[model samples]
Target: MNQESQKSVEYSQYYNLECRVADQVKAKQYNGALESLLNFITLVMHRQYPPGELIGSAKLDRLCEKIGLSFYHEFYGNIVHRDEFCSNDDVSVIICTGLFKSGGTSPLIGDIVRAQGRRKSTILATNSLGSMSGDDLAMSRLGEVNANIIICDKGNLVDRLHWLVQQITRLEPSRIILLNHHQDSVIIAAARPFTEKTKVLFYHHADHNLCLGVHLTGAIHVDIHNVGFCNCRDREQVADNFYVPMTINDLGSDFVRRVFLDKRRLTTCSSANPHKFSNFYFYPYHELIIDRLEARNGFHIHIGVMPESALQHMHHKMLERSIDPSRLVYIPWTPSLWKALIDNSVDLFIGSFPIGGARTAIEVMGAGVPMLMHENYLTRFHSSRDIAYPDHFLWQYPHEFTEVISNITFDDLQAHGMRSRDYYLKYHCTEKIGLEDELNRICDGTSTTRPAPLYPHHPDMLDRSLHFSYLEDMAIGHSIQHDRATHVAPVAAPLTPHQSVSLSLTQKTSKVIGLLTARTYRNALSLIPWLTKR
Candidate 1:
């Protein structure tokens, strides 16, 4: 079919699905309609695969494994055992939440949809959390299900989508997916350079404001019957065109086989950031975990970070609340420190932010340590969630984490270590499929889930943006001063190396290091001569 005609047919099919879903929701036949929609997506739009030349056999295998685990881990809840993913009978679906890098609310809704998988259900890479962060909504959905996985694409632009599309071309697995209109535009932009025959199922997560966009662009719409678009105000007619996919209760044995493989260690991962909202901001949740664990005694928690220097700035109050310094292992792993930190034998890995947590959590999972994430939909999409082991993916809320940790028995921890190795075999072992899927999503515009801001945002709304802008100006000014300072370097470092070395030796040699021998004293005296310039 030609592009325009094809898009029309697809849009019609989607609208039909939407009508059915809306009818179901209205008639209270929610469960039946949702199952039908998932089955339809699996049978129809998802079946197409890229040619072997475009995606090699080896590449395909890698892709399937990547999607298998990527989708499974995000929604199903990370399992600690490798054996947990023994069966692959369930169809995994990725929900294209939205276009923006932040606020993937529809992706959060994917967890609710994924529970329907008989073998394994997954909501993949919908980063636009509807309106506000709504991370709790995603976690709440995940908390209720054991069969699905939420495969979020949150990482480098090239890598994340590449991993996803590579899997699509390779595995040719049954994938029931949705792409929000805004994100679909971005993905379409990326995919335009590639072949146009590539069939991607697009679902508009937000329909109200986007109805004009879709209508104007003459875009094909999928899931228009069942999916609801968030963040679109004042257009109830567009919204009325569809219904959100309803909750599903009975997943199949395949789901049990797919997600319940080997047990994984229980840990959450994050890094420290100065932003009060950053996961590293030392929120009450972290303190609550430590306090609960310490009250029970013998709690060993390992918090991993990128640079070890960051640990020095860790809030003492937060640490004191959790456990003694010894029980909490702070890992600052640069390329230089990874080996040493791993050698320390960490059991469970935990992190908050997706960017810093991605590599660290992957390394820990590869080592057979399970991961605990407080379940932020933002990081899960743009960064961390995809790389995690399928069964090893544990989704937690900040408040309920202590209770989750309390449930992990010592035996479970050991079981998780072994399964973690299995997770490595299945997912994190390669970078191929993960890269492809992410690229595909970007190309397909499934990743671009939100509209750009209409104007310059409020300063508070743009904290990171404003901070970086300020820093950029400071950097430019600093650069100018440094250039000027270079001409006067000789005058600035007036002390000869030999003399300074001798003074250092003198100070080191003296226990008291009296004023005469101290560098501070010498510098003060030296400053007197340059007082006019100072």
Candidate 2:
């Protein structure tokens, strides 16, 4: 073959591999997806450089950009880049995400935009085109708020980074908000040089243990829950950290009353990821609740985002406990379908154990469905507790939880459900939280600023052994011993630019290793069925 033809063929292989990874991600086969991505990166690097040559940040960035662009095109088709719209507009806030999915950070952006009166200039920046069904549904929902959505088409990390930096620099956004852990490094790196001119905020949406050693120094940190703020404060001192509780659009009095009064078959639901229940320790709690609910004549449980294998395992566990399997039902998750279920069928929303469901719980409450949560010490974020639902809705022991489920009368459901709705309206309403005011403060330099932590100067600022052990205990099914060390102390100073870059590099390296390990485990699991069939 001619050299040009050979090059074209190799590039096509990489593009095909990226397409497969995007499909896998959409299918929720994340481990397999990561494996494919890592392999693609390795091959591209090898092709570009001689063997044993160290890959630098510039090359790595270029490779990531190439992969991101291929994935975007494969998923989204040939859509024109909306650079002109974003660049010329006077954008007040910029929210960045790797993908625009139905859950997590995307919805939060929608809420913020909705709360800000929809007139404020806001941008929803994403890396990929997003899954047609799910992402489009999410976009439609966010579209209600009328925010400009921009997807990066630049191939390779460097170009994408430059593109993002250019948008920020050109638009001169008052503040920039990053959505999740996945987009942290690239966004932070791109924004670091411009930090003095603009306020950048990283919102911590998950447990801190999952992303230890992240360089959050250059930007301010925004914790969705107070617990998350405390967690960040305890780990690394930043310029400033804000506790902005997540708010949703109120479902209104009519919907609240209707859902409260609807007394038919009792349906309990959860929209959390199914893998959360895959751990041996947490699955039993779900089974126990389902079993107790099944014993009652009118009660049933509906769970979304659960795979068939996990459902089967839970069913088997229920059977072992002499609980009827018929009560437990698995529902596939889609934005519209889940909302329909919430509005019409769901009676009680059950929050996930160990790691509480913040967004899901808020969503259920916003839809006027009362939620029941176990107040466990192991939960990384006490979202249930933070929401301050009535004491009757919070359970500590297994028997107590079962009793609450069994004894809940029609009146009790109505009263509790209304209370939840009221609480959501008062506390979680977008206007109530003053998102606009906060953004204004951030933009004008009136926002509170604490001394940033100098990690090199203060060694204690980097230590998280106790926190790691606590998370380790939760992961392994061991009981967590809550103590004074868990409390958030006043943060020390901030890290220097050099220190920040070093920390970010360290985290990126650690993430690469973590991804490899996870991919290996998934590959091994895939082998189990083959071995069993033999």
Candidate 3:
């Protein structure tokens, strides 16, 4: 068949499968619904590699628009523009974030900025805005705090930089805080003309190795975590940076009480991305620990927000190692993920190696769950060693992890969990951390001596910089290599003829049922004489 005809057939098949899934859901046949859903996903996966591309496509956006799936369209669509830029020169502070995703230190920083009672305008990068919505926790929190939010339009890097420059020039704020190094180059370029007017602050949330390309000389490097700040300060390039630890604003007294009061299971949870496990870096240690845990009764691992493909890879690895997959539970991404973690009675929270879980670690501790993390040189700048309570677990070697896991009893876990919660309250809580004071000091022209470059300058250092693009490429390459190493292909083969036919029949039946139901409703309405008279 021609391309057009093939696409038409594919659309028809997709629509039919969707109808079948809806019917199954309505009839409470969840298993059947799941099977149909999987078949639909398989079809989509075959058509689109990486899965993310499906959501990013214009065709999918158009289809969503035609189908009145506003939420889906908003979420999946590439371009996100929020033209809330206030021309008022009264705005003193401009808090700019590179990515729009709900995670990261941006939301926390935004919350702190708002709490400081300063006239501020927040700008979100276009790429980040695609993943956000009006109801998103970060957006809602910003709204509640009355921070003016501006989402940039999607464009090429140069176009985005020009737009950002235009916005910054227009706003003419006294202080500008760049959330991460992803947009440092743009922000630096934008503020170059207005360097004397606005003091730019670069908040380093990730490790220095991850952001080597970022030119820190132009901006005031502010490390939020103590150890992270120390690590950055020790570096010659970022030595003169300020230290302002993260403050958890949403943690209330009642929340703390609930955390301490709640009874939980011996289940362990990790919100780390499965891609972090793709390489043999930490997987061997993880496998060793998991095997030991599973050998004992009443122990389970609940992984959060792992992709289906990654989960499958992990399951296969477990099986290859003679481990049981039944003990491992995969939790998909959801808005109420914190509630889900608590409700599932996750007692112990685990952190990934090389790159530690910063936000997740704070959250798990705040929820009164003890966390254990493996620290290495790569994670020295962003590890749990500094933020976590002394009682909380941190291991450098595999044997250390095994020993910690083996000796810890239920009572010990509870004690450590409580300590972790207290540690969060004392150090990380917004009420305790004097973020406003530090922000005000910076805004008030409190100048600090600039530090020298830690590492010798290299001609090709910029290209080697572990920016998001570089990291993504590395992750993709690692995934491909890891898959090959395990003898797994990137994409699975097509379904059998029997499976396709069964799915098709389910769809056809569902369409018939839907038609019958619509017809019956129309007939009932036609039978009403009063309705006809009206």
Best-matching candidate per lDDT: 2
Ranking by TM-score: 2, 3, 1
Model 1, residue 415: C-alpha shift (Å): 2.1
Looking at model 2, the pairs that clash are 61-157, 65-156, 65-157, 66-156, 452-493, 452-494, 453-493, 453-494, 453-495, 454-494
lDDT of 1 at 496: 25
Give the per-residue lDDT of model 2 (tens digit) for 23-142.
Answer: 764664433443454444433332221111221223333333344344444433244343422322234565564434444566677766664543455564534212234344445445
Give the better candidate number (1 or 3) by lDDT: 3
* lDDT at 520, model 2: 33
lDDT, candidate 1, 1-534, per-residue tens: 667765534456546655665565455443333233333332231111110001011221222223323333332334323333222334444545332212223323433343343535554453322221334343332334454344444433223334444444333333334454331222322222112223333344333121112321112233321112222222223332222221122222222111221244233333332111222111233344454445444434333222243333234644655446554455432221123324444445554432233334444555555665544322222234444554553533333455556676666666766675565545434332242343245435454332212211121223234323433444455456766988543222121211112322112212111222123222333332232122
lDDT of predicted model 2: 0.50
Please report how far candidate 2 places residue 51 from its true position, in Å: 38
Q: Candidate 2: which stretches are off by over 4 Å?
A: 1-89, 115-140, 206-218, 257-265, 280-286, 301-303, 314-326, 334-342, 380-383, 442-534
Each model's lDDT comes to 0.35, 0.50, 0.48
TM-score against truth, every candidate: 0.30, 0.61, 0.60
TM-score of 3: 0.60
How well is each residue in 1-534 modelled by candidate 3, as lDDT tens digits?
677766534457657766665575455443354344334433443233211112112222222222222321233223332233333334644544333323455556565566556466555453211233444435333324555556664543334445665566567675666663321223433444343345666666634232321233356666666555555545434546676666666445444323322343356666654334322232232454465454443345544444465567557867887677776776645443345557667666667544455666666667767878755433343344556666467665556666666666777776887887887776667777666776666555473422222221122222223222333444466568768898976554444321234332112211212223223323333333332122
Clashes of each: 108, 10, 7
